[model samples]
Target: MFPLVFLTVIALDQLTKHLVRGGMALGESIPAEGFLRLVHIQNTGAAFGILDDARPWLIAVSSIALVIIIWLAISRRIGFLDNIWGRLTLGFIAGGTLGNLIDRAYYGYVTDFLKAGIWPAFNIADASMVIGMTILVFLYLRSEYPRSQ
Candidate 1:
């Protein structure tokens, strides 16, 4: 399951990046209109543009993190990828992580193409990661709530 999810994400991420790289130029933005656009930007940093110039370190850290996450999902049997909610969340994150990891390993940066007003340009993988995390949080909260008193 993890492998399948990872592959799907990586395929989608690479395909999108390839299309954007072939069609758009650096710093160029294509308006999707209504607060959305496709822009080509290479990020050598982590989320929100942190550590913008630490490619090697970022790669190392991300790789390690990915391994740890996978291990936890498989070994500890965490709820982040076993049931429906877990599967969905893990699928998104696995895909996103591999997508960015591919960039770090091959291009020394992550290729970000999707953009929206006030939001950084990101790719499908990033979206998956964000959405996955959001779902995980929602599930956690739901589980914590007391049943009807």
Candidate 2:
């Protein structure tokens, strides 16, 4: 189940990136109207444009984190992946992490194309990461307060 979800998300992320790479030039912006656009950019660091030029350290840290997350998930030590919410969250995180890791490993940067006026330009991987984190937070809150007990 984990592999299936991870592969699916990774494939989707790669496919979107392929499309963007093939169709858009660097620094090109395809307006989507309002506040949305497809803008080609490469990030060599973490979320929201942090550490933008630290490729080696970023890749090493990300690789190690990915391995740890996979190990925990497979060992069932991650608790969260034991339930539906947990499984989905794990899948999203795994896929997103791997998606960006692939870019870091191969191109020394992560391809980011999706853009919004008030938000940073990011990719499908970023969206997955955000969703996974959000789910984890929700789960934590729920666990802290059991329903109708």
- Indicate which candidate wins on TM-score: 2
Could you tell me which residue pairs clash in candidate 1? 81-86
The residue-by-residue lDDT of candidate 1 on 1-149, one tens digit each, is: 65677678879889999999899999888774658888999998988899988988887887887887677667746543456667667777878887898898899889999888898889988988998789878776676333433
Angstrom error of the Cα, residue 21, model 2: value is 1.1
Task: Write down the worst ten-residue block by lDDT for model 1.
Answer: 140-149
- Show model 1 residue runs off by greater than 4 Å: 32-34, 79-81, 144-149
In model 2, residue pairs whose N, Cα or C atoms come closer than 3 Å (at least 3 residues apart or on different chains), thus clashing, are 80-86
Residues 1-149, candidate 2: write the lDDT tens digits: 66777788899999999898889998888874668898888887789889988988888887887887687567876454577777778788889999998988888888999988889899988898889889878886667344534
lDDT of each: 0.81, 0.83
Model 2: lDDT to the true structure: 0.83
Clashes of 1: 1
The most accurate candidate by lDDT is 2
